[model samples]
Target chain A: MNIGILLKEGPYNHQASDTAYKFAEAAIKKGHTIDAVFFYNDGVNNSTGNMEPPQDDRHIGNRWVGLCQKNNVKMMVCIAAAKRRGINDDVLIDCGEITGLGNLTDIAIRNDRLVTFGD
Target chain B: MEEFDDDEIVKKIMHVMRNAPHGTIYTYEGLEMILIMAAYDQDISVAFVDDGVYALKKGQDTAGIEVKGFAKTFLALDGYDVEKLYVDQVSLEERGLTEDDLVVDVEVISSAEIGKMMTEQDVVIQH
Candidate 1:
């Protein structure tokens, strides 16, 4: 199964990012392929590289970056949304890419499952 | 165009509406998404839960709010082959609304049923 995830909230304020990450982890563990994780709305914040959580706390952004590195899953943040939120390419996580809504449309069309987590 | 069949390549896509109609674009854009996906020739259905039931209220006059009234736009969905509409029974009752108060026709179902149906779908997009 190929799964596409849509995350609509940022990292700390909501559980959306955590849930999406866990869901993707479980899916990959089950031998399913994750086509992409498309971030929209405030979700674009997940791609920012400037986040600095407490030293012992779980690093949400790094977790996503590692997921992309290990599983080869695409982490895409909406370019327009990112720009509006002041998340430019210079601040994007290393493994993530800033894309457009057209990529989201393609993700919807190609994936076997498209699940969304939001507020 | 792609082909879809109930027993074959049919994709069960459910658009879950969890936001209100006004104050934000989630509901409006979600409707647009459903309308677009409806034309894709796939098996499509809509579920209304949380504040989403408010989107179907009978007398929504957004004229005062300056936002274009899209409540009536939902009524036109049936013509585009997007007629499968379901609302969460708990959500409706919690909001002090009944089936008769809605502008369009919808099957008032339980959240359990909607949850089970969601697990079975090939795609579940929540807005």
Candidate 2:
């Protein structure tokens, strides 16, 4: 099955992002293909490649990027949402980058299932 | 991959358009996400009721506070194949608004019609 996961928050303040990753990993183990992972609202912060974690903390951003890279999943952050949250490739924040909703729409149009986890 | 019947699979997306005096970034964001999801499945319908009607309202001024341009993006739903846009009649009446107040071309229906539409989907996401 092709599944699209929507993560609407980052890890530091919400659990939705973490929950989405866990589900993604499990789904892949079950042989499901993660067509895309789209971020909206505050969730767009997950795409900042410049996230900073303390020495004692987990690299949450890296984890999400790694998961998508490992699984060949398309990580999409809503352009409008990302800009509002001040997250984009040119802005210099951390895990992900700016992407158009067109990217998200493409994934949605092709995926068999669309599941969103938000707070 | 396991084969499944398309008829057996249903997709339902409920959009929450909060037009509160303070405005809600999350609500609009949620709708955008649902729109992306609906664009993928032909069966997906986006229903906006209550405060959700504000989502399609034009002339938003959420500047200086860092809110995104949602109304503009919302106008692109039809190109994505998301043809079903619903607005509740009661919601509009309560707010003293009419179809002219909205930014998009929506099908204004009663709450009952919205309920019936929900029954057709396999999953429902209410933002």
**Among all candidates shown, the one with the greatest lDDT:** 1
Cα TM-score per model: 0.73, 0.66
Q: C-alpha displacement of B12 in model 1, angstroms?
A: 1.0
Error of 1 at A59 (Å): 3.6
lDDT of 1: 0.86
Tens-digit lDDT track of model 2 for A2-101: 9988776676898898889889999999999988888877777777767788979877778777886688877777788767676657743333556777
Report the TM-score of candidate 1, chain B only: 0.92
The lowest-lDDT stretch of 10 consecutive residues in candidate 2 chain B is: B1-10
- lDDT tens digits by residue: candidate 1, A67-111: 999999999987767787899888989888887766776677677
Which stretches of candidate 1 lie above 4 Å from their native place? A26-30, A54-56, A79-91, A98-112, B1-9, B22-26, B62-69, B76-80, B89-100, B105-120
Give the lDDT of residue A117 in candidate 2. 89
Clashing pairs in 1: none
